[model samples]
Target chain A: MLSRKAQYAFRALTLLVDKYDQGPVLISDIATKKKIPIKFLENILLGLRKADILESKKGKGGGYYIKDHPSKTTVAAIIRIVDGPIALLPCVSLNFYEKCKNCDQRNCGLHEIMESVRDATLGVLENRTLEDLRTGKETLAKKG
Target chain B: MLSRKAQYAFRALTLLVDKYDQGPVLISDIATKKKIPIKFLENILLGLRKADILESKKGKGGGYYIKDHPSKTTVAAIIRIVDGPIALLPCVSLNFYEKCKNCDQRNCGLHEIMESVRDATLGVLENRTLEDLRTGKETLAKKG
Candidate 1:
């Protein structure tokens, strides 16, 4: 399951995407609108800013905004930035691979199974973007 | 990512599946062979037993064994029993559904995307059983 941080990240990102053309959005507004705790949302936004997914400005009209076009940013990228690897096993992860000492990757059934799962999950996340969230047309179609 | 407890649970289950027809295997042996911590494996095994996926014996040769036929037990079932929901979002979960305060499910892109992820993941996990893990035939084929 997604950590509250990740969920809040998604909520905040989607909100930013919704208001992308309207200039930057205040963090306080995002927190209040999305029901995210202010302090926690601040950290999450900072992480996104650091990842280059978000940009922030200072002064009177300063706030956060998506750096890239919403379509250029995938859900997989966001999740990886905020929630870490998508793979169930570190060894099967593409960006966060680590050798699992518990089993041999060559013959570990668990490893193979998780690899498939990772692929399946990435198929969805890597394809969906903030643009998709902003319009919500695809989301509504799929929901039905 | 899988929790250490969930990873250990899968390791222990696969090990038990490997020895299904060979009578009970000692927890210490499973811990050593699978590189799982002994105390952790003990608790994992007990949890499996409680879920009715495993059974134990006491006295001389007693230990743990898969309760159901390996072919009957899906990886999805084990994951749910040991690791909780496979869905990325609570709203998307079939067995562990919870409404998110952050977004409306009817139009939430994250929820829609996660629902697809859940389906894709379950597609693989529900089809892969302990028997598949034990023989490793399909796993090896896919690995190649």
Candidate 2:
């Protein structure tokens, strides 16, 4: 399962992407729109800003907006920023690789299957940008 | 990530599949072999048994063995049994589906991407079995 934090990140991103041309939106508005707990959302937003996914502006109209263009940002990027590796096995993870204790990757039965899973997930996630998500299409990757 | 319990389940299953032809093995043997805490493993095994994945035999010269043939049991099945749904989003899960609060699934940006992720993961996991893990070979599913 995606952690609550990651789910919140997706929700927040969706709203921000939709309102990208409307200037910064208040944190309270985003929290309320997405129905996320305000305190929790504050932390999530901070992380997103630190990751360079969001830009926070200060002053009277202060709020947040997408720092990265929606076309360039993938859901996988958001997930990794908030939830850590997408792989089930550390050994199979691209960004969070770790040798499994007592594991022989070459001879391990789960390795091949787990690798396929990782590759398959990457195939989907790496291609799904915020723009595509915002439009909610049937996936362009399928046709290509 | 797979939970500690689910990882332990995989480790336990792999070991048992390796020793399948040799007859039932002791829970202690499995725990010691996999370095899983005995008490923790005891609970895990009970769940697997209840799910009909393992057949337990009591008394001397009797222990536990795979109830279902390893070749026929997918890792996906084990994870679902030990860890619940494998889908990243609750709304996309086949067994654990729930409407995302405030979500319009048809227009939700996260829905399509999450569904693709779930489909990709299931595509890989549903095809893998313990026998494939025991000997550690390229899956025939890959060729087909």
Candidate 3:
């Protein structure tokens, strides 16, 4: 399951994506719109800014805005910034590789199974930028 | 990431899968061989047994064995038994469905991306049994 942080990150980023052509959006506005807790959303936005997915202005028109095109910010990148590895098993993770405790990677039973799962998940997440997220929702809603 | 309990369950189950045709194996043997803590492995095995994936005997000449063929017991089933949901998001999960905390499922941005991930993950996980895990390792090894 996605940690609340990852979910909130997705919510915030998608908001920024929708308002890309508009002026910056206030944290409070985003919090109210997304039902994210104000304090928590502030921190999440800060993390996004640090990741270079978001930019902030100071004073009068101060708020957050998309720092890069939504298409350049993949869902996988945001989730990783907030939730660490995309892989279920750390060992199979490309960004967060670690040895599985007590198992030989060469023959660990879960290794191959988890690798396929990781690859499959990456197939979607690494490719689905925030731009695709909007259209993806529309497509699925129509399918229902 | 998989919780520690889920990983331990896989370790224990795969060990049992390897020795299925043989007589029951001691809990101590599995714990020592897999380097799983004794108490934690006990709880994991109990869960798998309750799920009917493992059958255990008591007292003299008693130990644990796979309740069915390893081919019949899938890695996906074990993961779901131990970890609750295979889907990364609650909305996409069939068995453990829940509404997203603050988003409308009909049009949430993360929904479609997460659905694709869940589908891709399930595509591999639902079909790969413990028997395939062993073969998967060899195929991967040969490719390397």
Identify the leading candidate in terms of TM-score.
2
lDDT, residue B48, candidate 2: 93
Top of the candidates by DockQ: 2
DockQ of each: 0.64, 0.66, 0.60
Off by over 4 Å in 2: A135-144, B136-144
Steric clashes per prediction: 0, 1, 0
Clashing residue pairs found in predicted model 1? none
Model 3 lDDT per residue over A43-139, tens place: 9999989988899998888899988878888888988899899898899999999986677787665777778788878888878787865623465
- The sequence of per-residue lDDT tens digits that candidate 1 reaches over residues A1-144 is 888888889889888998997898999999998888899999999999999999999899999999989999999999999989999889999999999885767777777788899998898888988887864565345532
Query: Could you tell which candidate, 1 or 3, scores higher by DockQ?
Result: 1
* Per-residue lDDT of model 2, residues B1-144, tens digit only: 988898888888888998887788999999998899999999999999999999998999888899877888888899999999899989999989988887788788788778888988898788777777775454445521
TM-score of each: 0.93, 0.94, 0.92
lDDT computed for candidate 3: 0.82
- DockQ ranking from best candidate downward: 2, 1, 3
Q: What DockQ does model 1 achieve? A: 0.64
Candidate 1 per-residue C-alpha lDDT over B51-129 given as tens digits, one digit per residue, 9 for 90 to 100: 8889999999999998888988898998898889999988889999988775777777777788889998998999888
Chain B TM-score of predicted candidate 3 relative to the true chain B:
0.90
TM-score of 1: 0.93
Query: How many clashing residue pairs are found in candidate 2?
Result: 1
Tell me which of candidates 2 and 3 scores higher on TM-score. Answer: 2
Worst 10 residues of 3 chain A by lDDT: A135-144
The lDDT of each candidate is: 0.86, 0.86, 0.82
